[model samples]
Target: MRKPQQLRNRELVLLIFAMALTLGAFVLVQFGAIGELDTKVLGVVGIMCVLAFALHIVLRIRASQADPFLVPVALMLTGIGTAMIYRLDLAYVAHWNVGTSNAGEHQMLYAALSIALCIGLVWSLANYRVLFKYTYIFGFLGIILLALPFIPFLNGGGNAVVWISIFGFNFQPGEIAKICLAIFFAGYLVRTRESLTSTGKRVLGFTFPRAREFGPLLVIWLISMAIIVLQRDLGTGILIFGMFVAMLYVATGKTGWVLIGVFLAGAGAVAATFVMPYVHGRFEQWLHALDDDLYNASANASFQLVNGLFGMAHGGMFGTGLGQGRPDITPVAGSDYIIPSLGEELGLVGVFAILALYLIFASRGAHVGVAGQDDFGKLLSVGLSFTIALQVFIMVGGVTRVIPLTGLTTPFLAAGGSSLLANWLIVAILLRVSDAVRRQPRAVIG
Candidate 1:
């Protein structure tokens, strides 16, 4: 194993570069939005930099052998998101006359809190494997979290019942539920891999698991459908199901599991279009976005989608430059539509850059999982990484019209406190796993 000090030094160098990238972005936003560089931008950028360095320091003391790229990649994505939101804030105040919108400032604060949480988790969690002990407990807790938004008193949000008010702050419990569920799925799959992989029905070169062993898959599918139907949230439902299926495939090394999951998911989606007006409307808007009647409709129209398309089209290949594009014209531009907002300003090149960061992050995580010495660690790491990858695909694909828009927040890049916190915590978990993987001794064969 390499020396911990050497790894920490490597991480420190990358951290400095990531901070510089963030600082440069803030500078660009300031100059482009206001036509002059203002020192006020430094307030948020400076605080974020301080918090980021503080996290690096914690990693130095606690997890020196952790993967260096994860932190830097996450920070870069979050920085780009904050810069874009800041640009939108300036536009909102100047042209839209929405003076009360301080979303950019609030996002900085949320990023700080998220980083602090990451520091605490990395500092306190001595072993990622300890979580395996509470596998069933986490599973139960995930169910409760997912159900919280259904409670009449706790449930609060428009269009989707995925938010709950806690201490006067609105949060999406589904975001937290995904983590708990990932933990649960990883641990559960570790315990059941043997049976899941046992020989069963062989159909056209694919060996499917027996009906007796299919309870878990069926239950998860039902839960996902319930989310889409009861909560009107297709993204989270699909996210949870996809994470489990990916982890299951990793555990069993079986391609049939993925096929079964896709078939179920496709069937559920088709059924949803007929059973739920919300799902049908989204499909309608997606398929006929350019049609005048649907596009111009007053209620549940494709206006937002059309505007987002136009915004990205206006940017073309290079982009309109940071803060110069009118990204705020789309509804919920800071959250679900943040990708298009970024696409419009950063252009195809910038969007590809952002996506490449996410790809690197996921690749690093998958590497950590493969290097893990224990099955539990392997499953957990892979499950978490798949969660992030699946989310980016759903959001970016929706914005580009490759799929129906499911209103999922872009991980680490969207303006949502719950999402930021959940994703940063995932980074913390991966860091711990990577550190453990590096610290383990290789076998010595006599």
Candidate 2:
């Protein structure tokens, strides 16, 4: 086997570029906000630079052969997000003057903390295969985390039961749960790939897994439905189910499992429309977004969806120029609506660029998964990468009115601590897996 380049030096070079991108973003925010550079923006850049280098240090020590582009891709997106948040913060201050929360400051702090967590994740897992040992444990923990938001005392968010509030702090455990569930899906599927791929039921030229092997799929689907039913979170539920389906297909190379999953998911959705008001309401809004009565109704209206559409339209081709667009007119512009906020400012070009970064990230992750030497590593890589893909699609699709809006944050770009930390870990895990993929050829030859 031919040896691939070590790429550690390449990663360092990219790290420099990534830091430059982030710095540039900070400067833009400063110019857009106060029309002058702030020492605080410089401070944030310094912190990001330190974190970027620290992450590079670990990559050099450990995952030297990992893709050089992953961190840089993530960094550029982070910069854009931070810049937008700062713009919104400035807008809030200028507009209301009453709400003085420095969300951009919080975002930078979260980025630092998230980087530390990502580093710890990278440092702790010298071997990705160790995760395979506790697959069931991860799955159990995932279930518990998902359920936590449903409890009365633990839940806080009014919209969906996805947040947990403790003391003075609030977080969305579903974010963390997605990561754990991906790992569990990967590890478990790796263990069972043999049976899952084997011949059993021959239905119209498709080979289905044996009846006994269907237990895992059944359980996963049930767990997904539970989240939908109990927590009223369609995005997380679909995300978890979609991750499992994608991982399962990767593991077994079987289309049957995917078909089964889709059928069940559709069946569940139909049932949900009948049983759950929330699900029905979303569907109503989605299907009748432009209907006179429905759009203007006092309750279950598509006001948020309509407003987001209008905001994007107002943004136009080149946007009103960053920090100048009225993203604040859209609800929750800092969180779920950040994309629209960005679209309003950055326009189509900026939106496409942001999406391109996501595409590159997902493709690189897919490349890593396919190149792995072991089944578990392959499944894990694919699962983690697919996790981001699913999320970006769901969030972007919802805001654009292409689909029903489910309360899901855009991975790195959206303002949410749980999302920030979780996505960073996803990047960390992929780095480790990529390193393993590169080292495998050498291990075999040696």
Which candidate comes out best when scored by TM-score? Answer: 1
The per-candidate count of clashes, in order, stands at: 0, 0
- lDDT (Cα) of model 2: 0.84
Q: Which segments of candidate 2 are over 4 A away from where they belong?
A: 1-6, 442-446
* Per-residue lDDT over 170-270 for candidate 2, one digit per residue giving the tens place of the 0 to 100 score: 98888888888888888887777777777878899877778898989998899889888878889888999999999988888888888998998899888
TM-score of model 1 vs. true structure: 0.97
Model 1: per-residue Cα lDDT over 1-446, one tens digit each: 67788778887888888899898988888788888776776777888889889999999889988988899899999998988888889889988988567888889899999999999999999998999999999999999999998888887777888999977899988888899999999999989988999998989999888998889999999999989888889999999999999999999988889899999999999999998888999999889999999988987799999999999999899989887889999988998889889899889998999999999999989888888668898889999999999999999888888899996899999998899999999999999999998888862111
Error of 2 at 281 (Å): 1.6
- Looking at model 2, residue 238 earns an lDDT score of 90
Query: What is the Å distance of residue 319 in model 1 from its true position?
Result: 0.9
- Candidate 1, which segments miss by more than 4 Å at Cα? 443-446
